[model samples]
Target: MDAMAAIKQTFFQECEEQLAELEIGLLAIQDGDVNPETVNAVFRAVHSIKGGAGAFSLDDLVHFAHVFETAMDHLRAGRLAPSHEVLKTMLRAMDVLADFVRAARDGGCVDAERSQTLAKELRALDPDGSGAGSEMDDEEIAFEPVLMDQSMFDDELEAAAAPPVRLFTIRFRPKATLYAKANETALLLREIGLLGEMAIACDASALPLLSELDPEGGYLSWTIELLTTQDEAAIREVFEFVEWDCDLDIESDAASAAPDDIDLAALIQKMQATVEAELSALSPPPTRVDPLAEASRKDADASADPGVIDLAKARQKKSEQAVGEHLGPKPDQGAAGGASQPTIRVDLDRVDRLINLVGELVINQAMLAQRVMEAGLARASGVATGLDELEQLTREIQDSVMAIRAQPVKSVFQRMPRLVREVAAMTGKLVRLVTEGENTEVDKTVIERLADPLTHMIRNAIDHGLESPEARAAAGKPEEGLVHLSALHRSGRIVIEVSDDGAGINRARVKEIAASKGLIAADASLSDEEIDNLIFLPGFSTAPSISDISGRGVGMDVVRRSIQALGGRISITSRPGRGSTFTMSLPLTLAVLDGMVVTVAGQTLVVPLTAIVETLQPKIADVHGFGGGARVIAIREHFTPLIDVGRELDYRGENADPLACVALLVESEGGVRSALLVDAILGQRQVVIKSLEANYRHVPGIAAATILGDGRVALILDVDAVVASSRADSAAFEQSLATAG
Candidate 1:
């Protein structure tokens, strides 16, 4: 990439961070957190993005962001009330602003008409044409110098009589909370320096003796002398982010003396002497590089005087400790110390490559162990012991690599609020979305694929599960519907649920739709759970008529297929007149699997351990054959289908003998228990999964393939698929027999 392209990429990356901050702040405000700092943070996010877009000459982005930022400014200054309707408009504007940014980065275009409409709405939110409104002038809107845009002021003669330069003495004392939030004093000081020529004096008089000091405590403060033509509002904007976390006072010397009349050169000398005396009286501060100066020097505008322009250069010559650099060894560390660990942004491709290499290592280690055992090496032998150690180490390495690919599900959850807003508007229903456990970590690959299915399920909940506002009111429920999304780690897997406090699934309607669509038998007897599941059948729709949101019979079935593709299972539980919840349980990672290797019809197969409820040696007496040559195994109290793996996979034409085979009791996706008959059960092992469909082609009864310890490949059983396929075949066979009879 060219230099300009690389820089542009960095800017876009920063834009993403800014956008996330903006969304978080807005959401917090929506949740009744009307903190001033939150408002400032939200304003700063939009301002920063606009500034970056200006640098790149992204006209559309800058234009949209400026309008959006203007509306937010009204809210920040308390000129605009954060009513639900206003907040709804702002959220939609935020989405459009994000779209503008992505369009700029990708060299595309957003819908101009939509952007223009939102921009007008944003503009209409401001109470006054001038940002200086009445009510918030004292508490929120500080004094800002307004410049005239008339032709007379545009002339050179009038431009020369611009705002006079004033000398300001600013005292900034940041609390420890400032540092805790990762807001550096150095950056704040640098921003101040950018406004004008400034000299800063670090006060170390409050510093305690080394033994008495708290590393994380804020003991130092700074007094700065700035000579600038900017107004007080411009200076305060520099400390906007840390305003609530620090004690900041910006005193303008404008009342006492003008910049030319004030002798800043002499004032700098006095401050320098005071700083030196304090340094001598107290223990000398730690020596460190000046991050502010380094940053200023790297800036393109570095040629202009930014700091200590009038002060003696000799004062800056000393290796003075940076005021931003506190006494702490690690200022950014979290309470538990893990947050202090420095991180770098690495390309995901590198992490994936490492994961693949670790998978190979696991396979190689297993192969070596198998070869050693085959060669008759005793388990107690030195070589065998070393192999065992190697095996453990290999597993450890694999786990560590997988950890690098694990990410919080927040990235996916953050996008749902927008979807909810858009869908709710289209459906003309008031909906409130509540999310919990967003920090649950799962494999990035799974999280990526999770978005689509989750989108479908959430939409289905609103469109099908949730009742209209009128209907809800008539049912004695609140007018607004509630959709809750949550995630958590369960049994070594991640489970996500999208629920709605609506009317729940309409079982009678669902069954009616299924029968009308010819998806199920007209007279079929099904439990409430079975009736609910009919929505998953292809071409089943409960919609009265087709619409954009749903109804071409393609929502839930696609959700099921998408979930199964990620080695996940989804189920639903609904309470009539209460709510409905769609629960999805997915693997934490797809790179490895814990399975019981079994041999069926002379071919080795692997059954996922998560699917197995229990295993037992089947007795011939317990196996009862039904019509169409199907059998069920009676276990404890209830009976489950007995599916022969050999016949299911077409490895043999006839069913395996019940007495000779082992029955592995497993649960399918729909919570149905089935006993899979296999010849013999091999020992369990953790095998590295290889995608069968990617390498070969899609198979009906297999999930993926993995290399066993003995260097042979085994097909990982898709237990749900096998059970489902067998049920279909048996149903077909029974119908054929009935017709013939």
Candidate 2:
């Protein structure tokens, strides 16, 4: 990529992070958290985007972000209240701002009408008319501080005084690191210039001889005398990004605030002398002197070569580290105490490559261990012990690599509040979205795919699950319905739920729709659970009419398929007049799995360990034949459906005898338990998952394929699909029997 393209890519990547923060802060404000820091963060997000857009000369994006930033500035300054109407407008504007960013990055066009509309609403939020007009011609609008006209004051004296314009003498010296971050002294000075009338003087006394000078070294500083109504805080905000990379000191002089008549050169010299005196008094003793400083002094005294400066600085840094270790851990070093750790951004492709290599290492380790066992190495033998150690190391390496790809689900969850608001507005429902466990981590790939299914589910919740305001009021519930979204890790998988406090699935209505659509027999006997499952059937719809949000018999069934496509399952539970919850359980990573190896009809298969509850040998007395060749296993007096894996996958023509097979008790995503009958148990191991659909083709009752220790490909069982297929066949058979009778 060219330099401009690479920088633009980085800008957009940073925009994603900023956009996430913007949504989170806006949502917090909507939730009644009007903390100053929260408002500041929100303001910074929009301001940063506007500034970057201006740099790229994205006129439309810059214009929209300017209007958006202006309104946020009002919110930050308390000129606009975060009332419901105002927050609603701000949220809409936020969505538009996000669209503007995406449009800029993807070379797409935004809806100008919508942008203009949102811009007008945001401008109207300003209590005064200052923010109500277009000032695109004012190039400084992005950096201009929020200020009120002095003429607005009632008292003449107050109007004349206007706010005391304090004089600040700021000394700014930027190191090479500052420029390395793409920050420029010229821009920083320009921002300070925007604050007020200013006189700036450059100090170059520290500059080394041309022959001795390092090109990247900091050799000059600027001292500025500014007279402005803005305080020290406003001046500091301009330098926030480069604060750690520069030495900055801002001194206020309210008594002598004149900048026009001051002698800048003389004043800076005097200030420098005073600062040097103070530093000398506080300096460490000679024995503890910084090596870099000593080296510089020696170079001056003996006229030594300046080439040793870098080596001395390295020595100084090393000495500081040694002393810090000798002093032991600092009280502030505790991670639990909230010390910020440094982080670096790496290309995601690199992390994925690392994860792939770790997965191969895991497979190779398994193969090596298998070879060792085949060679008849005893468990106590050194070779066997070494192999066991290697296995443990492989697992640790795999886990560490996986952690790199694991990201919090917050990225997906953060987009839902916006979805809920848009859906509610479209459906004319007063709905509030509540979220929890947003920090639950899952693989990046899974997190990316989660957004669509989650968006659909939340939309379904608002449009279909929730009732209109009047309906809610008539039902004695809050006029505004509530939709809750939550995510958490359960049984080595991420489970996300979208639930609503509205009149839940009307089972009668659901059944009627199913029958009318011919999805199920009109007279078929089904439990409430089965009726609920009917919604997952293709072409099933309970809505009376098709709408933009839902209906057309497309959403729920597609939701199921999408979830299943990720090796996941979705289930729903509802109580009439109460609410409904759609729960989805998905694997944390698609790359690897912990599975139990089992043989069925001489074919090996891997069952996900997360699904297995226990393994038991089925007794003859505990097995009973059910209708139409189905069987049930009695466990603790409860009869659970028993599925023959061999028969279910058509690996064998006949159902296996339950008593002779090992019954693996497992729980489905819906919390239903069943016993899967297989020929024999072959122990459990972690297997690297290979996508079956991508490599081969989608196989029924099989989730994916994996390479075993013996170098044979074993199919990984889709436990839920197997159980589901069995129930489906049994239901059909029973209906046939009813017809025969």
Candidate 3:
């Protein structure tokens, strides 16, 4: 990659980060709780991106950035107050800027229509329409300060007419490890001798005695006075490698001798010109070239003159290539120049592919272990030891690969604040979102899929769940309603819970909605937990108004379906006027699951272990009908619903004596436990989850299919769906029986 390309890559990465910060800041502002520091942070992110773009001569980026930064500066300095209208416009501007940066990086021209619209919006923020003269732009926009003026140059030229012998005083301190690798300070002195006439002085005051010295350690320091035609930078370059590890100070003779004869300004300008020429020559060519060809050429030349290869240039090239491959072709130079933003864009497909490969590796390793066991390696003397080592190594590799795909849930959670703020603003409520476990790691796929569901839950919590600020204060709660979003890994599943401290779900209101929607019978008996879950039924919202924020009656059910599709379940718990909590438990990865294999009518089925509560043998007497076709199993005093696996799956065979059947007790929505009677337990194993949607339509009670260690496919059961189907069937069976009687 060339210098321009490398700089462009960094610009996009920084822009992305700035956009994220801008999003968070806007959300906070919308919530009516703007923090000055957060505003400043967002301003700085934009400023940094603009600066980087300027360095690469991306004018388009610089132009819009200048305007956006001006508006942000006004807000930061308290000249302009944050309001709903302001935030909305700023968000739209942020989106436009993101597109501009992307277009620039891809070598495509910016959309003139969109750019003008965004520029108009920014200009509107300044009533005068000038949109200029921000102090920050004047002081902070320039990379560095200009050192000398033209008058200083003219005076120096007149003084330089009389040639003068310039003397210099130099002080140098070498780091402790400077002479440890068979190279001595003598080599450095020899190199310096070639540059000028020098007087060397050694400082040995800090060197310890022979007994106290470490054989491999260096202990020496030196200083020098040189009379040379060489410039100051040349003298400084002699200690460049050890600059950070040592201290060096150089004093020009003008300070100690006749100032008129020395003419320091003339010498400095000459040195600057020479440095600029050298830098321009060393810089990469202005024209673009094929990166692959460049890489090949560099690799071939690496052997001929190893010292000549610039590591910085090589690394820069690699980073640019990586970015291009990940984010597509570079944006047009003009489009890139206008926005000072930094962002690192990565392709989602690459992340998905990486996860898929890791999943396959895990399955193959499991198969290998199974083969070793079948070969009787565990019973053999030395074979068992080797097999154990192999298993350990395989497991280590699996863990390392999985770790690469795990990303903090923060990227998803950070969007919640904005959501809460928007919902609260629309509903005329005050809500503060408190988030925990933002750093918890989950599969990138899980994180992406989780964003929508989490947004819905948060919106619901703010719009319908939380009471108005006045109502909250009257009820003894804080004036600012609190909505809590938390996520954590429990029993191999990531559990995300969204809870609020305001008005909870009204059971009567939910029941009324269910009845009006014809979802439940009029006099149906149900538990409190069951009533709370009715909100997840399709089109079962109790909101009285239809607004752009949330209440069109089409979110909760979708959230549930999305969670279930990812091999997860969603549940709710609420207390009257005490708030509600919606908890969603999702699989660690969609590609694989830790499952327990079981046999039903000679067919193997995989049940995710996370849903299994216990296993037991229930006698015929414990299984009794509960009026409908459904049966209940009495375990101690509590009666749990029972779903016959054979009947549910339409399996036909000689019925196993009911008394001898083994029950796999599983928990479903709202703590509804069910005993699934299978033929036999086939033990537990990790299996790769293969999507049914890839080849076949989704089966009602099956989440996915996986290949077992024995190489046979087993369908993974969706316990939540099974329970749901059983209840629906029971209700239908009861209605049919009543009609017949």
- Which candidate tops TM-score? 1
Better of 1 and 2 by TM-score: 1
lDDT tens digits, residue span 1-741, model 2: 599998898899989889999988988998899799999889888888887888799989888888888888888998888998988898889899999999999878889888888988887787887655554443455575787886655588665565666778899998867655556777898899899877655554574332233434555677777778788899998997777679999999747444455565665466556544433343324565555444544454354222212223333433353344333333454322222344788998899889888888888888998899899989999999898899888888888889888999988888887788888788888989899998999999999898888887888788778888898888899999999999988889999988998889889888988898888879888889999989889888777788787678887888888898899999889999999999999999999999999999999999999999999999999999898999998999999999999999998898887778899999997688999999999999999999999998899999999999889999999999999999999988987897899
lDDT of 1 by residue, 1-741 (tens): 599998898889989889888888888898899899999899989998998888899987987888788898899999999888888898999999889888888768899888877877777787886533422322455678998767755677675666578888899998877776667777788889898878787765675443334445576688988888888899998886678779999898636344577677787777677666654465334674445433433341334233333233322322233223442234454233322444677888999899989988988988898899889999999999999899889888888888899999998999898899989999999999999998899999999999999999889988888899999999999999999999998657788999999988888888887888788888776778779888889888888889989979888999999998887778889999899989998989999978899999999999989889999998877899977789999999788899998999999998778899899999775567899999999788889989898899889899899998778889999887899799888867866776678
State TM-scores per candidate.
Answer: 0.82, 0.81, 0.64
Q: If ranked by TM-score, best first, what sequence of candidates would result? A: 1, 2, 3
RMSD of 3: 13.9
Model 3: number of backbone collisions: 32
Give the Å shift of residue 151 in candidate 1. Answer: 17
Model 2 clashes, total count: 0
Which ten-residue region of model 1 has the weakest summed lDDT? Answer: 314-323
lDDT of 2 at 37: 92
Structure candidate 2, residue pairs in collision? none
Global Cα RMSD, each model: 7.6, 8.5, 13.9
